[model samples]
Target: MPRFMGFVRMVEGGGMPPQALFDAMDKYIGEQAQAGHFLDGGGLFGTEDAVNFVVRKGETTRVDGPYAEAKEVVGGWALLQYDTLEEAIAGQQEFAELHAKYWPECEMVATLRQVSDEAPEAASA
Candidate 1:
């Protein structure tokens, strides 16, 4: 089985009620966990308040900014382990549907990659 990272994106201020989002997320987590697709996940704040960085010439620089200047930004993400990309995609679609009730334009990103147990830690650039 390969492990994947799932990212959920939403345009800032989509006005999704907090309780509704929470309930949907909870239900989704329960469903995915029961299916052995969920490892862990969490929501995030605005990108303006997110931690980010840039690296150049072997030097690392911390920046207070989002990767892109789009109305939609990554609001949260999860670590998932799935047997195949198809399963991961299915999970992503499910999550998007859960968010669509309040966040009709919410987008989802399912980045599927085989987890490498021996992957080395990246040096601070």
Candidate 2:
């Protein structure tokens, strides 16, 4: 099975979603977990206290947020596993649909990407 990461991106300060959305999401996550599709997942706070380490010219500098230039931030994420890419796509689509159906007033994007299992040495080529 291949693992996929689903990122939920939206503008900061979107505020909490409706309770109905939360209930629907809870049920949806429960179903996915029971199906062995969801491995781990959680929502995240906005980048008010986010930290960034930048390395340049053999020196590292630490930067703190909230970043002024960011238009969208990852509000939530899910680690999932499936037998095929189609299954992953379908799973992501279902998740996105839940948000669309339950929180139609908000705008968001669901990004799905496969996790690479390659060893660091093999990937360095």
Candidate 3:
């Protein structure tokens, strides 16, 4: 089976409670796990977990925080294993549908990338 990186971008909504969001994600994790579709996943806080860097005069500056100014940022993501890209896409669509049911105003963007040999390895067995 081919593995895919599903980059899930959460919609911007400061009013949403983090706990509620996490609870929803937990449901997805549970459902996917039962289906054997979930390999790994995690949710992240905002720029607090991000790192920023700059290079000048052969010197580099490392800053801690979010790097992008976009209104939408990746709140979390999951890796999925499937037989083909179409299957991955279909899985993502199902996820989106489920999310919509809970968060009617929330929107998510899922981008699928085929895993390459050069990709980082999973730390767990």
- Find the candidate with the highest TM-score and give its number: 2
Tens digit of lDDT per residue, candidate 1, span 47-100? 767776779988998978654667678777788988887888887777766666
- Using TM-score as the measure, what is the rank order of every candidate, best first? 2, 3, 1
Return the TM-score for each candidate structure: 0.70, 0.92, 0.72
Q: Which residues of candidate 3, in runs, are more than 4 Å off?
A: 11-13, 17-25, 55-59, 66-68, 118-125
**Model 2 misplaced regions, further than 4 Å:** 122-125
- Better TM-score candidate (1, 3): 3
lDDT of 2 by residue, 56-118 (tens): 999999999999899999999999999999999999999999999999988999999999998
Could you tell which candidate, 2 or 3, scores higher by TM-score?
2
Candidate 1: the clashing residue pairs are: none
Model 1: which ten-residue window has the lowest total lDDT? 105-114
Candidates sorted on lDDT, descending = 2, 3, 1
